[model samples]
Target: MRRGRVLGALLPLLLLATGCGIRSTDVVEVGDPATVEVAPGAQQGTVLYFISSSSPGGLLPVVRQVDDPSATSSSGTGDDGRSRGKQLALLFMGPSRAERKGGLRSELPMSSDQVSVTTGQEGIRVRLASGVNQLSELARQQLICTVAYERGQGTTVTVLGTDGSIGPARCSV
Candidate 1:
């Protein structure tokens, strides 16, 4: 009888504890029901891939406010790359003055004109004026991350060299 009373008391407690197992964080809600709409475009700032000062082999992604394209007068837009090519051009230009002061560097070629970008159904193709195999691993990574950041994470990018060599790579960032 005593055992029965003990179990009866513990049963309710056990049931109560199990009922509270669900956490507020366990549920995920997606999409907003509101009618408010916003324009789709590049964020006010841009992301550029550079070489880390401490680790020369690694890539350092930096976000900076968008500058006037005409100030430098590049080709592609930020990342969208529809109107003008800013992100890729700025990346090829290497780290900005402020960025260099902050200890970031770039392995990309000195001449930004040597690089060209074309978007196709297969994805964006980065045509390098030099041989793709000539690029160091760090340089290749720097190019991949920068273009991928603009195109979208994990997007397919083909690097074409002037020698008619084509290399396939994906953005791991």
Candidate 2:
């Protein structure tokens, strides 16, 4: 009778231990995830990617306060949500004095004037006034990474090089 009582007492506990706490039902739909929407009129910080030894891809992001493009330009009317050319201009400015001292660098291999970056319904495009093919792979990665960060979504950038050749670059990392 004692062994029967002990076995009966332990059986329920063992059953509970073997079962998951969530024994109720099928997969639950929690609806969509929340998203952060930036107000168009607000001053937004632009993200620029510079080369850094400590970063995962050697591309480090530095945020600088910029006048909100959506608030300032007609191009902002579209869903693209950013001023690509303007951000590229900022990227061309490279890392700030403090950033450089901290070991951030750039391998863009072109001046701001040498490249024209634009975005539209078709997507972000970069036209090189000079050499695009001549750019080293690292330099290309720097450009690709900056544009991807600026554009969001890690999308590809189509380059219109001076050689009348156009190609697309996507971030491998």
Candidate 3:
């Protein structure tokens, strides 16, 4: 009877502990900040920025640059120039769209051993670790950053590296 009682008591504690799982919801609207999708194939050598979404009346129509292999070849540039490094920026609005209204404004900055990035009005940041070849794959391997935003909330942003590995970070915001 004692053994049964102890096991029963521990069962509730285990259930309670396991029931506390972390979840996240993106508040930003779509098509505002503009989403930038970087597939593993698209990443070459240069850093890339992806805008998941932005607030209204915010900065629209951002310009992103990607290095062209053909241009480098024609110009006879060195290997650095020839490298498939590319940068992508997106413009969220056109001339007419700029006239629209604005939405809530917030900012989230992310930094890691590998790279540092600042996000706008989301209260979230993602930093990459150095010597990372695959980000997506690393997401499943380790805790990367400590996210700070919502109290009693723990979150994590996993980067999909070029090689298919997920980069690590700890997020609580």
List candidate 2 segments past 4 Å from native: 1-14, 17-23, 34-43, 67-76, 79-83, 110-114, 120-122, 163-166
Question: On lDDT, who's better, 2 or 3?
Answer: 2
User: lDDT of model 1 at residue 135?
Assistant: 77
Candidate 3 matches the true fold with a TM-score of 0.19
lDDT of 1 by residue, 135-167 (tens): 777888777776766555667778887666444
Clashes of 1: 7
Q: Which prediction has more favorable TM-score, 1 or 2?
A: 2
Q: Residues 1-173, candidate 2, lDDT per residue (tens digit)? A: 99999999999998898785656688999999998743232245666667889977767666666666452222334433245566667777777788899999887654756556666666668876766677666667777766665345567777777765444667655
Clashes (N, CA, C under 3 Å) per candidate: 7, 0, 37
lDDT by candidate, in order shown? 0.67, 0.66, 0.30
Query: Which of 1 and 3 is the better model by lDDT?
Result: 1
Best model number under lDDT = 1
Q: How much does candidate 2 score in TM-score?
A: 0.69
**Ranking of models by lDDT:** 1, 2, 3
